[model samples]
Structures are given as C-alpha cells and as structure tokens.
Target: MSIVSSEKNRCIVLVGMPGSGKTTVGRDLAKRLGLRFVDTDHEIEARTGVKIPIIFEIEGEDGFRKRETQTLDDLTRESNMVLATGGGAVIRPENRALLRERAVVVFLSVPPPILWERTRHDRSRPLLQVSDPRGRLEELLKVRGPYYREVAHIIVEGGRGTPHAMVKLIEKELQALCEH
Candidate 1:
C-alpha cells in the first residue's frame, strides 16, 4: 500500500528498542513516502567520526544521551523527513517534548525476547555488553516502555509484520490521524 503525500509536511520519527528495526523500517518508510531519512545514531557517528560503542566507552551513557538529544533536536527541525531515533531517546524529557511537538512519533514495539534474539552477539550495542544481555534487555524494556508510550503518536507492533506491512500500518494510522 502507498501513502498519499499530504501537504502537512511533518517529520516522522521512529522510536523503539535497540533491535526493533527502526533504521530499516524508517529508511523504507521514508523512501515510500518520498522523504529524506536520518537515523540519529548514524548521524551522531557521522558527526563525531566515531561509532556509538566508542562514544559510550569514552563519554559514557550520560554523555552519549546528551549527544543523542542534541542530534534529535537538530533532526526534528528538518521537515518532510523520517528519523529513526536512538532507543533511549525518550529518557530525556526535553527530547520527548521536542519529538512530540515536532514530529509524528512512531513506537515500534517488539517483545523483550525478540529484542534479545535480534541484539545478541552484536558488540556495537554498548548497553548490551553485559554478562546478562537478555536480562539487561528486559530491564531496559521495563524502564523505557512507558516513556516510549508517552511520546508515541502511533504504536506499531514490529514483531507481527514485515517491514513493508509495518509501514502500511503506520500509514493507515497516519491517515486516521489526518481524518480526526
């Protein structure tokens, strides 16, 4: 299914867990919608010329979160784009407010087990570099899920559908929003 481009020209921001397919789905959705796509984490890496894990190692999570918030603030200012935000973007109230005010926030919901399965063995994720990555994933989900829901305008079940199908579901939801 295709989404008709409305004149609204809003940014679409995808927020979810680390392995919830935000970058992949956001890229496809942006392509389908004929908009630019920016993954905040990628943008951060590009701007710093260092990978996220390195940033985490050097600056720590608080420092990394500062960068994420700054990147999101910058990206949200652009129009007619799809942005895939870092998993922990919602941790900051300012980031959440900016996202809600400036974009159509989509929460790509995946189960903790699925997230663990998808993210395991990935060394790039600094937060998951633990003796108990599965438990860490579960802990993060429990802590962050409410923040995601609070900021989300649409909640898409990522585990149940293909990326294209998920995009279609998001489009349908956007259409419903427009109707209202």
Candidate 2:
C-alpha cells in the first residue's frame, strides 16, 4: 500500500513501449497498493466497443490517438489508481503534460531487443505490424525515449524481474518518492 505524503491522491501512471510489462506490472502494483488498475488501451476498447486494431483500421492511427488523448485526460483525473498507457501515448505533448502534472508517471525502461523478443508474436500491436519490426522497435525507442523521460517522475528498468518483483520495486520507489 502507498503512503502518500500529500493530501491529494495522485495516480500512478505507467508509460512505456509495448511489451514493457506495463499492464502486468500495473495490475500487480495496483493490487499491492490497494488502488484501481486501468489500462488506457483496454479502457478505450471498452468505451468504443471495438478492438484497437479495428479502430486503427477504420479511423487510422490519428483517430486512435485522439481517443488515447481523451482517455489519458480522463484517467489522469482519477485518484488512487494505476494507469498503463499505450506505447505511443506520449506522442502528443498535451498527453505528456497531463500525465506529468496530474499524476506520478513511471517510465518502464526496456531495451529494443527485449521489446522485440516479448512482442514478436503479438499480432494485436498495430504499430509493430510491419516488416523489420525489430528495427521499428529500435526506431520507436529512439523517438519516444525523450518523451517518456519528459513526463516520468520515476524510471524503472523492466529488463529483468518477475511482475511480482517489479511490483515490489515500484512499491519501494513510490514509498521513497512519498518520503521525498
């Protein structure tokens, strides 16, 4: 559980590339912290009544991004929750500001190789549906790393560790952040 120093309850927002274990870690961390867990992608799907791929197929990435921004704005206002954002959520500067100002953002740092290894067989990721996906992952990492860092209050390395272990580490970091 968290020991938030301030009176306001800030949400814990997890930002990272696909397969960086945001959803998994967010769920565990939320459970440990006695908070709700919300994944922006899943919540989008729930609200739209369509899968993200279908949204991407019909309306394209731009439309999906609009939805993502709306969802990010909405979710960031909710207190005492863990939010897992999509890989490209930070593409928009407004979303980055919302996350940074409204919540305590955690960037899950995983290398491109590990990201490829984790997501190679995942067909659901619209961005990685291209030739030379490993290269694409590296390109994305290069492009988005700065944006992630811009909003992150804590950066957790997710290259190694079980979800449970990662949750413990995040919990410790959250506690330490509270102390500071």
Candidate 3:
C-alpha cells in the first residue's frame, strides 16, 4: 500500500535534538511543498514575547515544556505545514499524542557526536549547557530515541548536506510515499 495521495492533507513534523537541522530543513521543505513553515521554539518565543533561553531561565524546563506543549497543540490544528519541534518536545506524552494524531512525524536522525560538534558552541540550548553535554546527549538520545521512533512515520538521516539538499531528499521520499 502507498501512502502518497493520503499524505496530502497531512502536516510534516520534524523531531530531533538541537542542531539536528530541523528548522533549516523545515523551512526548505515548506518552500518546496509550497506549505507554511513553523518552528515551535520560535512560536513559543513569539507568543510569550521572550526567547527560549529566557523561558528556561525564568520558568525552567518544566515551564518551558508547558508552553511547548501548548504551541504544539495549536500548530497541529492546522494542515499542510512543516513544523520543527524543540528537541524536548517528544518527552511529553501529550505532545507525542498530538504529533501522532495530527501529523506525519519524521525523525531527522543525527548521531550524538555530530550533535555535540554542531551544538558545542551554542549556549542557547538549556540542556546542553552542562559540563558534560556530550554525555548527557548520549544518555538523552538513548532514552528519547524510542519515543522519536515511535512517533515517526519516517526517519531521515541528516547527513552533512545543505538544507536545500535535505529538503530535496525529504521531498523525494514524500513524493514516493504519495505516489503509491
């Protein structure tokens, strides 16, 4: 059975750790598909009138998560969009439920080593600010990998390519799925 035509109304939800290229790929994917693009982190920041780092600083992870969950709920209510969720968004069961219910989740899989290299200098990620961020990322990946896989209808290995290339790859896969 092919999922191609049935995927027309579906939203594409990108899930991955920080620096996994979710935002970049989502923007490209949306453009390629002529759909709207939304990043949950940006949406949270916009709605709250504060940055994600500030949210983490003020409300902590739990508080930021509440906002993330709400944003995910609102974004999923629409169709034909590419949504890039924050890395921790899948940690909550409700967020997962909303993602599974409203979108075709895709895991932009990145190895822990690559993630460390990409995010090492980035101070914006609250969780990655720890001393042993790589170790923490490894542990987190081990725990969250299953959740990501569970929610994802597809998995795309995010290699060392430009966002446009990644978009093309994703579009190929999506078009293939749609054709059947």
Candidate 4:
C-alpha cells in the first residue's frame, strides 16, 4: 500500500546530520507520496526574512534552536507532509519527545567522512563554518546519535544510495511499520 494511504493526519519526518540527504530525500518522498514538503531551516529563513547564518550572527545557536522548536511544534501539527529537520533539531529533549510523538521519524544515518565530503564546500551550514569542520561533524554525530535513534522509528543508511533509493527504502520500512 501507499505510505500515506493508512492515515490522513500522519507526517513523515526526516532527521539526520547535514548533507545526509534529508532535504533531497524528503522532497522526493513528498512528491512521490503526493504530500507537501517542509524543510525546517528553510521555514525559519522564510519566517524571519533572513538567512540562517545571519540568524546565527544575531540570535545565536540558542536562538536558532528556539525558532526550530517553535517551527517543529507548528509543522508537526500539519498532515500529509514530509518534514526535513536541521541536524541539531534532536539536541533538545523536548524536540526529541515531540518528534517521537508527532510523526513517523526516520533517521538517515551517514558516516562522518561522507558527510564531510558532501558538506565541505557548502558555506550555508552554520555549524560547519568552523576551522575544523570534519572534527565538528564527528563530534556532533557522536553527541547526537543517541538522540536521533531515540526519536526515530526507523533508521536508514543514507550515503550509499541515491535519494530515490533512500526514499524507496523508507517507503518499504513505512509500509512494514504500517502492517504491524
């Protein structure tokens, strides 16, 4: 059966490190499932009329996280959508609790090396702007891994396949989950 056929009010949430293909996979999954797509980072930028880096420069990571939590609260209430969250969204216990309760969460697990390769040239990620970005990615992964696992109903390896393939795997897992 189609992933969305089971419930009208359900949402598919994509959580992972930056460059783990959450946004790309989410867009594909949403289109294939005929659902709306929302990226929390983009939503924040849209709402605040500023880029994330600018937000970081002004309100700082703490502030950005506050916006993220608020956005997650609002977006998780919507149905028929695929939501791609920021890498650090799982950093807070409250965010983890809400994600676990509000949607069928998928954690895209990609190794730090691959994530570094994918994100090395991207200047948009506020966290990766440090002098040793690879080290930061690894550290972030180590700290956040448990949180992602805690919040996710499914964990899918992300770096080995195309976004479409990942979506197919996610769809298979979602179908299996629905059956149980």
Candidate 5:
C-alpha cells in the first residue's frame, strides 16, 4: 500500500483510549513528518487557562464536550497538523464525521490490560479518576470501541513501548498506505 505524499501531508488525527499515548505519539509523528502537533486536551487547557480535570469539575462533562467539539472543529478547519484527540472524542458522531472529513484518523489500539497497567497511577485523567478505574476503562472500551473502529482510517496496535517506537510503526504503515 503506497500513499501519496500529498495525501500523507494532510492532517493526521490520533484517537485512542486514555493511556494509549496519542499525545506522545502525535508529537513524534509530527516531528518525523515535519508537521505541527496539537493535543486537543493541551489546547483546551491553554485556551481556557485551566486543566481538563478542573474544567470537568467546574462545568461538567457536557460543558467540556461542547468545548472539545468546538475546538476540534476549529483546529481541523484551520490546520494541516497532527492532532491528538481526547479518548472520548470519537464517541460523538459529529466529532467522528469532522475527523473523517478533515484528517486521516488513526486508532492507537491497546488492550485493556495494558491500558490499566499504564494508567493505574495517573490522576490527571478525569475519566480514569473513579474508585474502580479499571472497571471504568472496560466500560468505556465497550462503548467506544465500535465508534473508534468506524472512524479509523488505520489502526495501529500500541503496546507497552516508547512513543517513538509507535510513531515509527505508524509512519511505516502510513507510508505504505501512500505507496499503494
């Protein structure tokens, strides 16, 4: 599969679960491709001057999601960059539509067990802050997996490894896609 360099030059959006290393991999992918990288979560925090967890606390998930949708809409419309979206971004049909229209949506697939081991100690993720974070992850996966699959142009298996390695693998796959 060979992908045209022109097509590969379009925005590359990374979608995955909380601990799937989207942000980290997006940065490396962007660097390797000479494209700008934007993490929607970081953009939200920067634009609002508040962390995501704090936003969720003050405005609730509904408010946070609205902001997320707006931000994604704006970003996808304005730039040809690598975007790392939130774990739940694909849950909304509108978001999925926008992503599919504007970018090469890639799902960084990681097993639930790997996700649990990776995120067990992370306290910054609002969705994973529950008393039973592992259970919550499972529930989320069940609901979101199909949506992720539906939107993904490519799916990369991301195990417990450095973001650079994952990025390398994705780049290879993407290049192959272009060649075909």
Candidate 6:
C-alpha cells in the first residue's frame, strides 16, 4: 500500500482502461514528483510518425500491440519516470510481468459508464469503432479487470476529479509509502 518498499526503481507506471486519464494524470503526477513523464501511446505515435488510429488502421490491433509491448519494455527500464501505458497493455503476460517487476504499477479505475461518457465521441479510439462502443468497453473491462488487478500495486479511483486533483491523491498515496 505504500510507495516505499523493497523496490529500488523509481519508475511509476499508470495502467487502466482507455478513458481513465492515464496520460493526463501521469503527466501531472510526474511534474509533481519531479520525474520524467512518458505516455506509451504517444511514444508509439512518435516512433511511427502516425496517430494511433492510423496505426490501428494500417497494422491492426495485433501489430499495434506488438509495438506497445516493445515500448513498454523500453520505458520500464528507465529510472525516475512516470509512464502512462496503453489500455490493453495488461493483456500480455510479458507486459504485466515487466510492469510489476520494474516499477510501481497504478491502475486508474473508472466506471464503465464514466468511461463511455469520456470516450463516446472520440474517434481516435480504435477499439470503440464498434456498433456499440459502450458494449465493447464493458466487454473489455470484464476480460481485463483481473489482469489489471494482478499487476497493479495500487488502484486509484479516476473519476470526478481534475487531473491536478487526481495527482494530489496519488501524491498522498506515494507520500504515505515514503513516510513508512
């Protein structure tokens, strides 16, 4: 429950569903903590020189996932960084292991309804292109919930708060660990 522990690495990884505000909160959290901030999805886009939706269109989810895993592997190795991971990063066992072993993994949990509200009009989410995006989100949550829990060292409620407020809550949690 504490951020301080036997783990020596200073990396903090944020994991969760697509609309959980990982990138926003992670950036603020990193700034508050004075660590580098990196969003895996953005890293992927930067490397490929295309938006994620474009990558999904060209390479399919499988190819994008391969790239995600590679990026996650590389980012987790760095010290003093806050990394916002892709939503489905926990689907792969290797990614889960790397996240758990190399850094403090925090799951930003938001209810499905809230997630839908946040992402409904976002065309960039490749997975939500279905006839019923809410249905897809619910389905993904059902399958991925356990993996998220399995890899998370902490679970933070990610709803009804500004990114700065969420960062404050996370900072409190991390500070509690440090105090111990």
Cα misplacement distance, residue 1 of candidate 6 (Å): 16
The segments of candidate 6 whose C-alpha lies over 4 angstroms from its true place after superposition are 1-7
Report the error of model 1 at residue 30, Å.
Answer: 0.5
Going through the candidates in order, what is the number of backbone clashes in each? 0, 0, 3, 0, 9, 0
Question: What lDDT is reached at residue 157 by model 4?
Answer: 92
The residue pairs found clashing in candidate 6 are none
As for candidate 4, its clashing pairs are none
Tens-place lDDT digits, model 5, residues 1-180: 223235433688999999898988998888888888999999999999999999999999999999999999998875558899999998778998998887788899999999999899989999988889999999999999999999988999888677888998888888776776
TM-score of each: 0.94, 0.96, 0.92, 0.96, 0.92, 0.93
| Residue 168 in model 2: lDDT | 87
Pull out the clashing pairs in model 3: 2-180, 4-177, 4-178
Arranged by lDDT with the best first, the candidates are 4, 2, 1, 6, 5, 3
> lDDT per residue, candidate 6, 33-147, as tens digits?
7788999999999998999999998999999999999999888878888999989999999999999899888899999999999999999899999999999999999988999
lDDT of 3 by residue, 98-177 (tens): 99888888899998888889888988888888889899899889888999998987888885777787778787777766
The predicted structure with the larger TM-score, 1 or 5, is 1
Predicted candidate 2 versus true structure: per-residue lDDT over 48-156, tens digit per residue: 9999999999999999999999999898887888999999999999998898888888999998878999999999999999988899899999999999999898999
Q: Weakest 10 consecutive residues, lDDT, candidate 4? A: 1-10
Badly placed stretches (over 4 Å) of model 3 are 1-9
Model 1 spans with C-alpha error above 4 angstroms: 1-9
| Model 6 TM-score relative to the real fold | 0.93
Q: For model 1, what is the C-alpha lDDT against the true structure?
A: 0.89
Q: Distance (Å) between predicted and true CA of 100, model 4?
A: 0.4
Instruction: Judge candidate 2 at residue 1 and give its lDDT.
Output: 39
